[model samples]
Target chain A: MKYVITLLVGMVTGAVAFVLLLYYNPFVGNQSVSPLAVSELDLVDFSYSLLASDSIVFTNDGESHMQPHPAKVLQLWEPTVKMTRALVTILNDSRGQPAGLGVKFSSDSEKTRLINAEVVVDSVWHIYSPEHGTFFVDQTENFWPYLHDIVVPARLSGGDSWRGSWYGITSTGPGALGIARVTGGAGDFADTEGEAVESIAARAYSAITGPVAMTGKLTIALPRQEALP
Target chain B: MLKIFYLGIVMGIAAAAALVYIYPVVDQHREPSLITVRPNGGNSESFHIRLPGDRIMAGVTGSTELTPLALEWPEHDFLANMQTELFKVRNENDVVIGAASRMSGWSEQHGSFVEWVVHLPARGSMFMTMAAKPSADGYREGKLRAGTREFLTLNGTVIERFVNEADDSDSDNVGRIELVTALVGLPDELE
Candidate 1:
């Protein structure tokens, strides 16, 4: 009888622990030794040429499974912006599980999101092909390898007076980033996305139930940072 | 007694699960960061720099915030051509500081062009404000002519830097304005 009680107590304790684990969370574990040999990128086949027409590329030497910071330049002259950049981040769930990123673009200018692709944790990606206005990349999580020519329209041209908004997320909808552009380069960053390549905006982790809509910073200009005194 | 203990254990497990779920929310925090990108108003975009990166802040070019300027347009559209700098936020002698740009609209939709995205170490920022007096020149198509300088040109916002050997006085900080390319101007559609 004592053994039975002890076993019962132990089972309950484990169950309690599991419940708590599912509720509260801790700091997502730090980025492990990225398997990509982050330093070897200089020697690898990764090159700027990776970017094709209407696109740019940022090659990184990180863990094969890690999403790295794409090449990017944050600041530019307001009058004549010549380039653009992308902010890349790897989102991990409470259990430190990567919840893939869903990428999308919208010239519709009607809503804020233009979701077009999904970068699953399995290193697979899905991108919307303008040819059919449909999402592809059914096999890979990383689009960096096979993104083809696409029109990255400028955010605001004197001709269109348009505002292009792009957003990314995972299947669970936990991790996301919204990108906006004003002018030049169609702004379709396929390869290199930003200068001084690093995290541009804040990282948004999804809510527990699922990836809830994020209420993070929308624009990188004057991103509430200490850049300007 | 044994049954009581099991119920208590289950209760404890449930409580713990509840705690775990509420943790991330109670500790809601996000690092204030930004990925500087060229605004493309499109989905596929690119960023040149990550402003507020660790280094830019450490390597202070003596940044300054200039008074924002307001731009005026005509009653009827011309070709979004209007350029007239209002005031100069000077730090010219100050080499490599930061620049900020933001524009406001009165009646029409807020002009997205007013926001300064230039990464130039501004030595000066123009806090401009004025109302445009549009005449019957009527709106032009391609480019605005000098007769009606109403066309917005490259009214570059200048940020003065410390001259090679200029007096390094606090006032020595000065930047010049070289109206680069007003990407989104008083739209050509709007005269």
Candidate 2:
């Protein structure tokens, strides 16, 4: 009886093991499908420059399959798109009149509050309105360049307010793309000293106010006249 | 002795199950465009119409939940534009999953806007793309004499009005704003 019981147990165990192996990885014996080829995905980079000055950058890695119609190699598996926005805003005067705005597209994603901008042309001089507060933008330099600089200019307007809007310039291409936007920092010059830029910049000055939100669009296809061949 | 043999069998089955994996080359979706904006007028910054709820399509690794981003400057049409076109590859249910993304001119890590939480089974895979930001295109808002040369401030950012394919003033038209990804994320495994 003991021998029979031991034989029965052994047979049951062997059966279970066989079933598990067969069902779990039926292809284990074949070895025809290369593990590397099965899961292997190729990575490719892509970029597109819009008719406008804006540009896009991206990366993608997907299946190298053939298109149904064209039969062309379509990386159907991997797809990516990037857009860049040049942040700018328009304000209103007492007559409820509208005025011109400015924008600078700083690529670096680092740096929290500020972005370094190049004046593409000599149009107008800009300043931070105390009432409207300070606008946040990605710094041209590394992240947190002004880790401790929070001194508002001595001459700051108080109680006064201004209005404005933001814009984004995005673009894309075959594989990858890029999008740009002005760094809209969390808040005005974060007083490394404190959150009292109002008091510091105000300095018993006149009235100042905070800036308001505005709108714009992402111009992808630019006219040939406005674009470089 | 019999019990020991049974245990070994059980262990072998478990081990085989653990080794199971499928490299699914999912050509599930195409283009992966979640947003599109049509220009109505020649050059106008007007919120004339909308597409309701202003929803956006997101695709992540496998199937994972996502969160709505609270941008510092929400009011600007930026959110609107992002909503419709914030295209990200996702699972059937629509989750922004990311394990590996191959995008040029950019590098990305999980948990950027939404809380980053995702994992892959042993041989699982994930693929995604990050869209580039605007302004980096080099189109200057005309030019600036001084101050922060970026977004809205006291004076505001401006660029010279150019022309588009229509030869009309190159008004604000988001040519293409998208982000896509797809892959097998772990099945409810620790994120």
Candidate 3:
């Protein structure tokens, strides 16, 4: 009987101790190493090509050569733009995480709009343009969504390719009695749709270190909008 | 005594389990943290922290208050291209610490703004503010400002300051305006 009684007491004591341990939160302590620190090395190289199209409307005034005209004609203007870039590098920071990106372009070529643009990604992504200084790309911003979709996935290896489409509206010129004209009317506008395609292939030399290469193409074609007769 | 031993063993197991869970939480809470920048007019998404062994810890708590320091937008045809706004956070040495960007709308609206709060270890804290302005001539400009009140020990005390400006033309003929500022001092470790 004594033995059973002692056993019961011990069980009760142990249960109470367990409850206390949970309540006091004894597990709270410091970590020997920071989990946030990244220690791996990942090197990536990529190329991008783009072809896009937009629909534009142009106004044609047969009589007015330079001065303003009250009434004018309407015409459609379609402009196509093609851009390509090669040998972009993604570099890691001291923490072994993706910290910066550098893109090299041919300075002599006018087609290279972004020349030597360096982007640093720490708390925020900073795209540094020699002509524009630094620009921030956040999730709330327009540029972030497009670049994020392309750059984030392209950093990894194996089947890294993506395609998408976007649409926008543009207007030009002054108000001419609320007339629907392009470049000279009160409401001259162009509705544009753009498509982009990207393909990236990566080769990992080692478990912690490797090289990744990507090639992308974007084509933008502007279509003409006919006037209503 | 044998029953007591068994009870102790069970209690030890429970204690170990509890410690394992609490250790990480305590460690994370004490470390410098940051939150994910929420999309404009969208729900808040979880912030991710990369862990060892291909593990990731999501939904970590950190600051999301990004403040603008300066802004400059050149006059141009606004309707020709989509308007853009960019925000950057930098230390006193003019080193960029954080940044964010978004599309500016073509409307005469007021009070449209976004902010980010950054904490620098042993240096100080700062908040960046980027406010959208009314579109003029189809060109949209943003106002930038910075403050240290969120983590400032004293109100109105000058801790650090920065300025950022970006002005360039893109292929689309869109005149770009930039803001660059060194808003906070570097941490003691960095210095």
Instruction: Compare the candidates by TM-score and give the number of the best one.
Output: 1
Give per-residue CA lDDT, model 3, range A1-229, as digits (tens).
Answer: 7666665666566666654554344443211221112312121222231210000111112221211111121111111000111112232333443332222111011111111121211111222222112222211001222233344444453544433332211110011211111110001111121111122222211112112222222111112234311
DockQ of each: 0.04, 0.04, 0.04
Q: lDDT (0-100) at residue A24 of candidate 1?
A: 31
What local distance difference test score does each model get?
Answer: 0.22, 0.22, 0.25
Error of 2 at A3 (Å): 14
Q: Alpha carbon lDDT of residue B108, candidate 3?
A: 25
Tell me the spans in candidate 1 whose CA falls farther than 4 Å from its real position: A1-67, A70-229, B25-191
Q: What would the per-residue lDDT of candidate 2 be over residues B1-191, giving only the tens digit for each residue? A: 75766665565555543433222211122222232232531111111111111112221222233212211221322222221112232332233222211112111221112111111111112111122322565332221111222211212122311222232464434232222221121234214
Quality class of the docking in candidate 1, CAPRI style: incorrect
Report chain B TM per candidate. 0.21, 0.18, 0.28
lDDT tens readout by residue for model 1, A1-229? 8766765776678675664443232432212122222322211111111111111111122222212222232222222111111211222222433322112110101111112221122111111111111111111122210111011121123332222232322111111221111111111222111211111111222212111122111111111112212
lDDT of 3 by residue, B123-149 (tens): 223333343342444322222222222
